[model samples]
Target chain A: MLNLNNLLLQVIRLLLTFVIIFLTLIIFGVSPFDVFESILYGSLGSYSKFIRTLIVWTPLCLSALALIYTFSAGMWNIGIEGQIIMGAVGATFVARSFLGDDLISPYLQILMAMFFGGFWGLICAILKIKGKVHEIFSGLGLDFVASGIVIYLIIGPWKRAGIASTSGTDIFHKASWVPTVGDSNFPIFLIILVLFLYIFSLIIFRYTSLGIRLKATGINTFATNRFNFSSEKYIVFSFLIAGAIAGIAGFSQSSGAYHKLVPSVSGGFGFLSILIVLICSRNIYFTFIVSFLFAALIVGGSQLQIKLGLDHSLIGIIQATFVLSWLVLQKIEIEKITYKQISKMFAK
Target chain B: MILLENTLVTVISLSTPLIIAVIGETISEKGGVINLSAEGTIMICALFGFIGAYETDFAVVGFLCAMVLGAGISFFISYCDINLRMDQIAVGFVLTILCINLSNFLGQDYVRINGPLITKFSIPFLSDIPFFGSVLFNHSLITYLSIVLIPLSWLFLNKTSYGLAIRASGENPSSASSRGINVKRMRLLSCVMGGSLLGLAGASFSLYTKYGWSEGHTTNYGWIVLAIVIFGGWNPFRAAVGAYSFGLLQVLAIKAQSVTLALSQILPLLPFPLMIFILIFIQYINRDEIKNVPKWIVAILGGNQPQSLGKKLPEEIK
Candidate 1:
C-alpha cells in the first residue's frame, strides 16, 4: 500500500517540519537538540513513561478516529470538543449515582458517553441541516455551551463538601475508574477498547455500504440524490457516529486519565485530533500513527518544566507549528518541487 | 442618576475593543473572506501589544505592533487563500491554534506585568453636558475612536468608491473583474485593513480596558466578536449595536456575580447560544416562505450576509 517515493516525500516533509520547529525553539532561546532528546527519553525511555504516553494516546487516537467519520461525510464537527465534554458529563452522572459502586458502572459510562456525545453531535447536524448554519460557527457556539454546562456542574450541584471550586468534581467511585491490571497500573481496559474500536472501524469501512455512502455524501451532496438517498441523512449519521466515538474519548479522559470530571474535561485532545486528521485525512492507519506521535509529544511535554526548566506551552507551539507547516507544505507540493529540482540537478 | 451614568460609561468604555474588532471582521467578510483566526489573532496581538508598551513604555507603539501583527496574519491568510489554493477556514483555524500558543509561550515573561495604560481625555465643553457627556465624552482617545469608528466605517463602506469596489469584488469576482477591478488585490487590501483594526482592538483590551498582561488574557472576546459580527448582519452600525449589547451583557454579568457564581459563569457564555439562535433566525427570515415579514423587523433583526462570504474567489483578475 505504500510506495518508496511517497515515503521519501513524507520523510522529507517531516524533516522540514522539524527544522522549522527547531529554528522556532532556538529563537525562543531553547536548544532544539536537547528538547528533542528530552521529549524522546521522556515519552519512551521507560516502561512507565511509555504507559503514560499510551494513556494520552487512547483519547488522541479515539478522537482522530471519530473525526474520520464526520470528515468523510464532509462535516467539520468542530463541536467534537463539546461532544467529548458531554461524554465526561455522562460518565460522571453514572459514577456519582446509586450505581457508583456497581461493577457495571464503567461499562455503563461507555453507553452514556455515547448517548450524550452523539446527542450533542446531533444538535450540530440539526443546526446545519435545518437551521442552515455553518458547522464551524454552530460547532464553535456549542463548544462554549458545553463548557458552560461543565462549569455549572462543577461549581453548583456537584461542588465538594463545604467548598465550591472550578477545580473539578469528586473522584469517581474506584469501581467506576478504568480498571488497571497488577501493580503497574497498566491501562489494559483502555488498550483493549482502542483495539476493538480500531478493528470495528476497519471492518465497517471495508465491508459495509455505510462507509461508501458516507464518503459519497462527503464528495458531493447532490450526487447522492441520483443514488436515491438523502446526503442529509448521512450527514446526520456521520455526526452521530463521530460524536459517539468522540464521547468514548471523553469517557477515557474522565475515567482512565483524571478519574473525575473537570471543567476542561476535553483537555483539547478534540482540537488536537482535528489537526491530526487534517493532515492524515481519511487514512485510518495514518491517523493511528500520527495520534500516537502527538500523544508522545504531549506526554513528554510534561517533563519540560522539571528537566529543562522550559514551560509546557512550548509543546503547544511545536504541535501547532508542525501541523501548520505540514499543511502548507502539502498544499504547495513541496515534495513534487523537490523531486523536480533533484532530477533537474542530476540531469544537469 | 449617577449610578445609571456610571453604568453607561462603563458599558461605553468596555465595549470599545468589541466595536473596533467587529468592524474589522465586517470589512474582511465584506471582501469575501472569513478570518476565523480572530480569536487567536486578538490573543497574540493582545500579548504583543502589552509587550510593546511594557518594553517601550509608549502605548502608541503597542497599538502599532498589534496592528502589524493582525494585518500580517490576515495577509498570510488571504495570500494562502489566493495563491496556494488552500482552504481559508483551515488555514485560519490552524493559525488560531498556533498564534494562541505562540502568545502563551512568548508571553510567559510578560504575564501580570503592568504595561502602559491609555489615559482618559475629556473634552472641556463636552464633558460639562448633562447626560450624553458623562456617558460618552469623558473617555480615553481609543474609546472615542471606537465610538467614531461606528459611523466612520459605515460611511466608508457605504459611500466611498473604494468601498464599492471591494464590495463588488466580494459579491461577484467575475463581474467585478469585468468592471476592471482587481479582485485578488482588493481582497488582500481589505483583509489587511480588517486585520489591523482587529489588532487595534487587541491592544485596546490590554492598554485601555482590561489592562495588564496575563496568560489567556482577552480570552473568548475574539469569538464573541465573531458572534456579534453575525448579529450585526454585515452592516457596521448594526454590528456596533451588537457589540454594545454584549457590553451591556457583560455589565449585567459583573453585577450578577455577587448574587451567585453559577449565574455569573453561565451569563458570559450566553452570547454563543444567542449566536446560534440569531443564525437560525437569520436563516428563517431569509427563507422564501417568509413572504410577509415586516421591513422594520428586517431593518432591526435581518442580517444581509455577504453574497460571497467564506467562498473561494473564482478567477484572478489582473
Candidate 2:
C-alpha cells in the first residue's frame, strides 16, 4: 500500500520537523547538534549498541504488533501492561520450576506466557462485555492489579533465597535464555519470532476473512449486526489475540533481555508501544518501522544522561511532540497537500 | 477516641488535594468530558506549583500559575476533540505521557528542594464545634476550600442553570444544541475550569499535603483522582467522600508498612480494583438487574456517568 512518492514527501516533512526540534533544543539551552550526534552514536555507534537496539526492538515491535489487533477491533487494550507482566510471570514460572535447567523450558514458557496473558486479557473483555464496564476502566484496573500481583510474588513467594528484594529474582539459568547466535548476542530466536509474527499479521490483515470482519466490527459495531456477525465476539477475539501477542513480548523481555522476573517486568514499554501504535495509525508496515526507530531512540536516550549531562526524559518529550504533530498534521491533510504540490511541479 | 479523631483529622487534611481534584474531574465529566490527562496534568502542575512558590515565596502564586497551565492543557485537548475531530481519550492519554515526562524533565533541578509550606488556619467560630470542628475545620487553607467546594460545586452542578446547561451538554450534546445550548463552548469552558481545579489539586500536593517538589511528585495520585471521581459517581459531594476514603487508605497503608513489605505497596492500589467494581455496579443498576437496590443506593453510589463522556462532540453540533 506504500509508494515511493509518499515516502519522498515524508522525508521532506521529516527535514522540516528536525528544524522545529533544533529550535526547541536551543530554547532549552542545549546544543541541538551535539544532542542529535550523541543519539546517533549511542544507538548505532558500536556492534554491542546495535545488538542492544535489537533486544529492545524485539519486545517493542511485538507490543506494537499486538496493539494493532485491538486497535483494528476498536478497543484501547490499556491492560497491555498487565498482559506483558503476566507473560513474564509465566516465563519466570518455567524458569524457576523443576524444568529450570532444561533447554525445553523456553518453549514451555512461551505457551504458559501466552495463556496467562490471554486469560488476563479475557478478564478485561468479560468485564466490558458482561459487567458493562468500559474497557479503559477495566483495563486500567487490571493493569494495577497485575502489577500488584507481580510485586507480591516478587516480595512474597518468588523472592531470592535468604534475602528478599525488589530488584528481581536472581538471573535465571542460561538454558532458559532466548538462544543467542554468538558472542555478539544476536538474539536470533527473538528476531525470528518477531519476523514470523509480523508476516503472520500482515497476511491476516490483508488476505483473511477474519481480519476483514475485525475491521468491519471496529469501523461500526452496530453495522456489523447487518452482516450477521457478533461484534462482541470479535471484541473478545481481538483482546485474546492481542493479549497473547503482548505475552510473547513479555517472553522476549524476560528471556531475551533480563532473563528473570522483576517487579517492573513490563518496563513501561507497553505504554510506549501505545504511543508507537498511535503514530503508525494502525498501519502494520508503519508500526514495524516506527517501533524500530523508537527502540533506537530509547537506546540512544541513555546517552543524554551519560554524555550530554541531560535528563533522559527529553526523549519522551520529543516522541510526544511527534505524536501530537502527527495527529494534528493528519487532520491538516499534509500528505494530500504535499502530493498535490509535487504533482503540480511534475505537470509544469 | 483520640486516635480515631486524629486519624479522621489527618484524612480530611491529607485528602485535600484528592478531593479538589475529584471535584474538578466530576465537573468536567458532568460537562461530558473525561479530562483523562489527570495523571499528567497533576504531575506537571505539581512541579510548576512548587516552582512558582519556590521562586515567588508565595504558595498562592504557585497555585495561580498551576491553574493557568492546567486550563491551558485542557483547552488544547478540547480543541483537538471539538475542532480537529480527534478522539478525546487518545489526546488525553498522549498529554498524560507528555506532561509527565515534561514535568520530570523541567523539574529535575527542583527535586527535593524546599518550598513554601501551606499553613493551618482554623475558622474563627467553626474550630470550637467539638469533634466535627476538629475533624474538618482545623487544617490548611486549601483543606477548608476543598471541603467547602464539595457543597458549593454540588449546588452549582445540580441547582444552577449554567450547571444544567453543562450537564445537558454532557448528557446529550445533540439534544443540548437542539435546545439552543452551545455544546462546544460549554465543554471547552468546563474542561478549562476542571483543568484549573486539577491544577489546584496538583499545587496543593506540593505546597499543602505532601509538601515539596520531586520527580513524579504527584505520581499515581492523578490516576487515583480519576478513579475517585468515578467512585463518587461523578457527584462532587460523594466524590469528596470517595477521596477521603482513599486518604484514609493511604494513612492505613503507611501504618501497615511496618507489618509487611508487600501490604503497604498494595493497599493504595485498592481503589482501581474497587473503581472497576463500582463501575460494574453502576451498569448493573442501569440494567435493572436488582430490583431491590434502594433509590439512595443508586443516587449515592453512582448511576450517573455522563452519556457522552470521553466522546467527540458531534460534527452536526459544531
Candidate 3:
C-alpha cells in the first residue's frame, strides 16, 4: 500500500513539475517547444555536446554516490562542498610541490586529494563524536573557512604573478593533467575510475556485512549498540569514504575539465548532487539516470543563455520546484491516509 | 578614544541585521521549528529587497516586499515540515540552495545597480548626549528598531502568555498540546514571524548596512547569524551581544589588514574558524562530566537548546 502511494506521488510530482516548467517558460516569453529543441540540441545533438554532458556527468555521479553513504548513515554531509574544495586544494598543493617538474605522476596527486578530502570529513565526524557540534553547523563552518582559504590563496600567495587575477593558479604542468581521449579532453581514465568506484560501492552495499552494519546503524543507532556494533565507527568510516569520493570529484573538476584550479571549481556540484540524491530517494538505479538528466539540464541551461537569451539559472527554478513539489505531494499522500483513517473511526 | 568610537559605530551598524535575524531565529526555535533556510532566505531577500527598492525608489516598499517574500518562503518550509512530515533540515537545506540560485538568476539585472537607501535619523535630544549619543542615537530608524527589537523579543519570549506557550511548545510540545496550546499553530506562527524578521534583516543589508545589491551581497552573514544564536545560547540579549562582537571582529580584521599586508588577508578568515571553535568550546564546557566550574561561568557559557526542537508533534494530539 505504501509503495503504491509512493508510485502515485511520484507520477503526480512529474506531471506538476512539467506544468510548472511550461508555465515558467511562458512567463519568460519563450516558446516551450523552442527551449526543448535547444536543450535537446545542446545536450545530445552533437558529439562535442555529448562529451560535455559526460564531463559534467562524471563528477556529478561520483558526488551523488559519495552522498549515498552519508545519507544512508542518517547524516547530513552538507560539508561535501568543503570536502571537494579541500580535495582540489590538496591536489593543487601536490601538483605545485613539483614546482613545474614533470616527474610526479598525476595519479599520485589524485590520491593525495582523496587523503586530504577524507581528512576534512574526519574532522567533521570528530566534531560530531567528541565536540558534540552538529554535523550541519560544523560542515557549514568548514565550508566558509575552506572558501576563505581558497580565496586567500588565489589572491595572496598562490596567485598568478604580475596581475593578481581571480583566475587561479597557473595551469599545472601538462604532466599533471589527467590524460584524455584523442583530440578530446574527455577524461577517459577518470570516467573509468568513477565507474569502477560506483560498481564497487554497489556491490559492497548489496552483498557485504559492512553495508548491513551501516544500514542497521543508520536505522537505529541504539539497536546497533544492542547488537554490539559500534555505530560511531561505521558513521566515521562512511564519512571518510564519502569525503574521499567527493575529493576525487573535485580533482576531476580541476584536472579533467578546467586543467587548473579556480575558486568556483566545484560549480555547485555538491549541492546539485544532494538534489539528485533526494530525487532518487535512495534507489541506486534511479541515481544513475537522475545524475545524467541533471547534467543535461546544466549543460542545456548554458545553451539557453546563448540560444534564447534566457538565464541558465532557469534550470535552478525547475529543479527546486521538482524537489519542493515532490515533498508536498508526499505530504498530501500522508494526509490522505490519516483523513481516511479518521473518517473510518467516525463511521464506526 | 576616537578610534574606539569609530569601531563601536561600525559594530553597531554591522550588527543591526544580525540582531534582527537572530531574534527571528530565536522566536522560531522557541516554538520548536528550526528554519535552517536562513542563509538562502537572507540572500534571496537581499536581492528581492534591492530590486524592489531599485524599481520603486522607496526603501520602505522594498522592506515590505521582502517581509512578504520571507513570510511566504517560511510558510512553505513550515507547511512541508509540519504537514508533510519531511525532515526540516533537509527541506531547509534544499530551500536555501533553491532560493540562492533563484536570487542569482532573477537578480542578474539588479546586480551592481544603485538603489534607494534608508536615511539615517538621529533623535535631537539623544544626538547631543556625548558618548551615548554617538554610540546609540546616531543611526537610521531601522537600526534603532532592531535595537528596540532585542528588548521587545526578550519580553515577548519571557513575559506574555503566548511567549510562555512558545517556550512550552519548544520544551515539551506534548504537554503543551495537552494544555490546549495548539503546538502546530504556534510553530507555524513562530516560523512566519521569524522569517519576516529575516526578510527585514535582508532589506536592512541592501537598503542600509551594505547599501547595494550585488551577486553574493551580504555573503555568509546568515551562517554567522546562526552561529551567534548558538553562541548567545538562543537568548535574544545574548545573541545581540554576540552579533555586535562579531561585527567588531570583522572591523578589527579590516583594520589589522592595513597594519600588516600579508597577514591581513588571512586575518579576515579568522572569524569563521573562531566561531566554530566557540561552538565546540561551549559544548565542551557544558558537558555533564565537567565539575569545579563556577556557577556564573557555566550559566554564561553553556547553551541548553530547546528539548523538543526538530521533532514532529504526534498527529494524535490534533
Candidate 1 lDDT, tens digit per residue, B1-318? Answer: 989999999999999999999999999999988998999999999999999998999999999999999999999999998888788888888888888888888888887877788889998998999999878889999999998999999888889988998898888888998999888999998899999999999999989889987888988898888888888888899999889888988999899989988888888888889889888888998886578888998788888677777878875555
Which of candidates 2 and 3 reaches a greater TM-score?
Answer: 2
Interface RMSD of each: 0.9, 0.8, 2.3
Candidates 1 and 3 compared by lDDT, better number: 1
Task: Name the runs in model 2 displaced over 4 angstroms.
Answer: A1-16, A333-348, B294-296
lDDT by residue for model 2 (A104-192), tens: 98899999899899998999988989997888888888899998998889888999898877888878999998888876699888888
The DockQ scores of all candidates, in the order shown, are 0.82, 0.82, 0.59
Number of colliding residue pairs in model 2: 0
- Across residues B122-240, which tens digit of lDDT does each residue of candidate 2 receive? 88799899988888778888888998899999999899988999999999999999999989999998898899999999999989888988887887888888888889888887888
Candidate 3 overall Cα lDDT vs. reference?
A: 0.83
* Residue-wise C-alpha lDDT for candidate 3, range A222-290, written one tens digit per residue: 999999889999889988998999899888888777878888888889988988898887667888888
The reply for model 1, stretches above 4 Å from the true place, is: A1-7, A335-348, B315-318
RMSD of each: 2.0, 2.9, 3.5
Ranking of all candidate structures by their TM-score, best first? 1, 2, 3
Instruction: Name the TM-score of candidate 3.
Output: 0.93
What TM-score does candidate 1 get on C-alpha atoms? 0.96
